[model samples]
Target: MAKKHKPRVKAPKTASPGEVMEIKTLISHEMESGQRKDRKTGELIPRQIINRFECKYNGETVFSADMHPAISANPYMAFYVKAGESGELEFLWHDDNGDVYSHSQKLEVA
Candidate 1:
């Protein structure tokens, strides 16, 4: 069964134009590395992890990261972005099983 993944973000809803702000994001995932065995059946667990992560602002790429098997479960990321204008921020996570999870938030600038 496929598990549902969810992304959480912490960002200011409003910011001053040209001001720098910190953005934090986290995604829920098991991050199975295929090296672990099931205690019940002693079967090798298939690897499952979010292989990539990206954040975009107004269709423009702002930040991205390449993930690996060594990554820990429930990945957490934090970055900084300069305030520009009112727009939407899009977050995307790519899984090894060809799955993509997305989250979006709106920002307002004065």
Candidate 2:
């Protein structure tokens, strides 16, 4: 059985008007690459990894990335975005197992 996934996000609660803010994200995942075999069963493991990642600010896409099996477990990403107004920042990670893990944060610009 697969373990539950936990996602973490880091962003400033407030930012200066039009200033660039750094965003960091990380998620717990095994990120199986499908290249190994079970020791007992001797069967090839299936590939299961976070295939995509996206970030949206104020309902608009800000940063996005396409990942592959080469990515390591517990993937971490850091990016930058311009602060706009008070709104929500949504982060999403899509896995090969049809699972979508998400997290959100509120940012206020002064």
Candidate 3:
């Protein structure tokens, strides 16, 4: 079974309408590159890493990123978005092994 991961997100709870705010995200992952040999068996560790990330605000995509093998473990990203309305901010991380990590935060516009 694939390992479970914890995702972290930082977003403002409230903002002025049309204001740009910063959003931060991070996820814990091993990010094996498949080039390294296992110490015990001397076999290559299968490559497993988060390959893509997406963020949506109120059902509209705000930011997205494509990850590569060169990306370090526990990937972190920060981006900005304009405050629209009181709604949900959804985040998703896609792993090479077909595992997806999800997180959500709510933002209220004043």
TM-score of 1: 0.90
> Residue by residue across 17-106, what tens digits does model 2's lDDT show?
899999989999989999989999999998999999999999999899999888999999999999989899999999998989999889
Backbone clash numbers for all candidates listed: 0, 0, 0
Q: State each model's CA lDDT, in order.
A: 0.91, 0.92, 0.90
Across residues 8-102, which tens digit of lDDT does each residue of candidate 3 receive?
89989899999999998988887888789999999989888899999999988889999988888889999999998999899999999797899
| Best-matching candidate per lDDT | 2
How close to the true structure is residue 77 of candidate 1, measured as C-alpha lDDT? 88
Best-to-worst ranking by lDDT: 2, 1, 3
What's the TM-score of every candidate structure?
0.90, 0.94, 0.91
**Candidates in descending TM-score order:** 2, 3, 1
Which has the greatest TM-score? Answer: 2
Question: Which stretches of candidate 2 lie above 4 Å from their native place?
Answer: 1-3
